[model samples]
Target: MKKILVITLAALLSVFFIDRSYSKHNQAVIQKTLINEIKEHRQEPIVTIDFRKLYDFKWDEVYVFTPGTSLKNIEQTLGFTWLDAKSTGIKNRDDMDLIVFVENNQVAQYIMLPRKYGTLQPMAQKGNFMVKTS
Candidate 1:
């Protein structure tokens, strides 16, 4: 009976690990596909943000923002809501707005632009912010 129980437990553990790995793999594939699509067709030019200057955000290296990052995370990181970020003004430019793309209730991508001029800037600039999350 003990041998049978041990064998059953081992089988269950193996199945669980396999399922978890597969799920992670699928998520990664989905993220990669989405990023590739965005890179190929994004309207605004691509610019790499120096995340280090911003608050310390702990996430996977491959993804710009971790999968499942919520509004709470945004508030914590930026000390403001998405709308607030968008409505914020820029020097010598009209109002700025953030174009947020959400997927499954999480932020998938965001792009910032001047209200009148559609130009891309460094992430540190007032009217520039772009990111992709899983």
Candidate 2:
């Protein structure tokens, strides 16, 4: 009977040690799916901005959240209107000023992973970060 309890406790503890942030494998799969969706929908990169400038800029504001964060809570987290770093006019190039999604207890970054997931998955489908619903 004690062995059963030990096994159960071990299993529960294992879950806590699991890599919580969306894994690279998971994000890659999602990115691949989204990339295919964009291709099917005829979405192409139309604008080219100096992304390095944004990356180096001392962000005017920054927010970090674990994977599966709700879009509805964003305003509450920021205590103001929802603002994306890409559109903000605040530019100071020393560090990245952006909302960060982390994986493996570290920042998750995919250089070409288009930030238009919300436009592609408006309903916040599975694996999607932003949705237009309450």
Candidate 3:
């Protein structure tokens, strides 16, 4: 009886570990997909003559890419509600306002813009829109 009990416990442990590993693998796949989509769309090159031109990129089609996270999950994790986001109103700009259901500082997200019009003041400007965590 002791031998049987030990074997059962070992089997259960093995199953637990297997399940955990499977879950991690699934999560990784999803993350990779999200990153790829972002890079392909959000990070695309700019080639336009107007302010709204940047929205022509493939990434613009994807309004939101919640990576394994729901609206409620974001609110709980970041401790806030989704506000508003919009364009910067610049020419050939791809900047985006990522209004979230959370505060800033919880996440680090940014975009690099051109050095034209001296907007960055003698330096390359990168906009950072992180979830403000207080």
Candidate 4:
């Protein structure tokens, strides 16, 4: 009976330790994934940025705008579009300034990942950062 209790206590302790370790390393692991994704998608120079660096800048949701898609399409994809862009003489899809959002200095998210530019995936399917027109 004593042996059974000892084994059960050990098992519970091990589980608790493992869970704690995972929680402690979660942020670092997330950062690594972001970096890898950016490296995979980054072309030539690899234009990368971090969220904390651009904390001064606010952003909207990450919107995917494919060819044949219009502003309305972007609005739908992003859930919000720059109403001012349309009114402020900022016309044309190419004319819109889209900034990629990164975390821990990695390109973790963006609006578009054109094959010509590069294919970028976020570390997490969803992150704390976002892309928007600057």
Candidate 5:
């Protein structure tokens, strides 16, 4: 009986880990696709964002990157390079607005942009827009 119970528990644990891994793999695929799309659309015009709703967050620093800014530079600008290189999707120059959220002096979810910015739809809506001038 004890042998059977141990086998059952091990099987359940393995299944749980497998499911978690698969879920994470699925998310990475989605993010990779999105990053590729951003790269493909590099020539596209900059997207606008309304800052009214954005001010709600207690961001330690907010930066507006214009055309021709590299992703690594952004990491440097934020004064931290601990996040994944792919976190920002693609290089800036798409008029990327980075809103940083800090907790206990540590960055919280540097991956927020890639996950929240699908089609950049949540932004580019009605409100005061910052026009980028070359």
Candidate 6:
């Protein structure tokens, strides 16, 4: 009976340690991939964004965008289109509707709304910092 109990406990402990290690490793890989994707599409010679600071308050993910960063750039980096750029009213300085909300110098959320509608619609968001979208 004692030997059986000892073996079961050891197995449980091993599984727990293995899971923790795998989670950490997976997160590191995801972070590295995101950074590389951003760097590959950015117009600047050196990418300046520090990805470590943008932690998801709930989902454990990161979201980033800058003022001049175009919707096309985001589409290329993320490999998905959230909204049509033409419909977002991002024409010239007067019609521009892109906004990058930041907290503590890190991009918390990005929104693109049409000028005519004048309503907030998140193009990309992360965690509890911004409204969740489907």
Whole-model Cα lDDT of every candidate shown, in order: 0.43, 0.40, 0.34, 0.44, 0.48, 0.44
Against the true structure, whose TM-score is highest? Answer: 5
The residue pairs in collision within model 2 are 56-94, 56-95, 57-92, 57-93, 59-97
Residue lDDT tens for model 5, 1-134? 99999999999999999976775575455445445545554555543444445334343433444335576776676676635434544453353433333444455322223322333433344433433221
Question: lDDT by residue for model 2 over 1-134, one digit each (tens)?
Answer: 99999999999877756753444455456447544554554543432222223243222333433333444554465554444433322233222222343334333443224334322221222223322111
Could you estimate the TM-score for every candidate? 0.36, 0.28, 0.35, 0.30, 0.39, 0.36
Q: Model 4, 38: alpha-carbon shift in Å?
A: 14
Clash count for each candidate, listed in order shown: 0, 5, 9, 0, 0, 0
On the 0 to 100 scale, the lDDT of residue 131 in model 2 is 20
Rank order by lDDT, top first? 5, 6, 4, 1, 2, 3
Superposed on all Cα atoms, the candidates' RMSDs to the truth, in angstroms, are 14.6, 13.9, 14.8, 16.1, 9.5, 16.5
Q: Of the candidates numbered 4 and 5, which has the greater lDDT value? A: 5
Which residue pairs collide, candidate 6? none
- Candidate 4: where is the Cα deviation over 4 Å? 1-44, 57-69, 80-82, 88-96, 100-134
Which of the two, 1 or 4, has more TM-score? Answer: 1
How many Å off is the CA of 108 in candidate 6? 20
Candidate 6 lDDT over residue span 28-131, tens digit each = 55545534544454454333333334433323333443334566875565455555434444443343245433455343344442233222232333332221
- What lDDT does model 5 reach? 0.48
> Per-residue lDDT for 6-124 in model 4, tens only?
99999999999997677447534544554555565455354444444433433433323434445565455444454432332223444223334433433334432323443233334
Candidate 1 lDDT over residue span 8-100, tens digit each = 999999999997677557545543543454455455454343433432323221122232344455555543355533232222233443333
lDDT of 2: 0.40
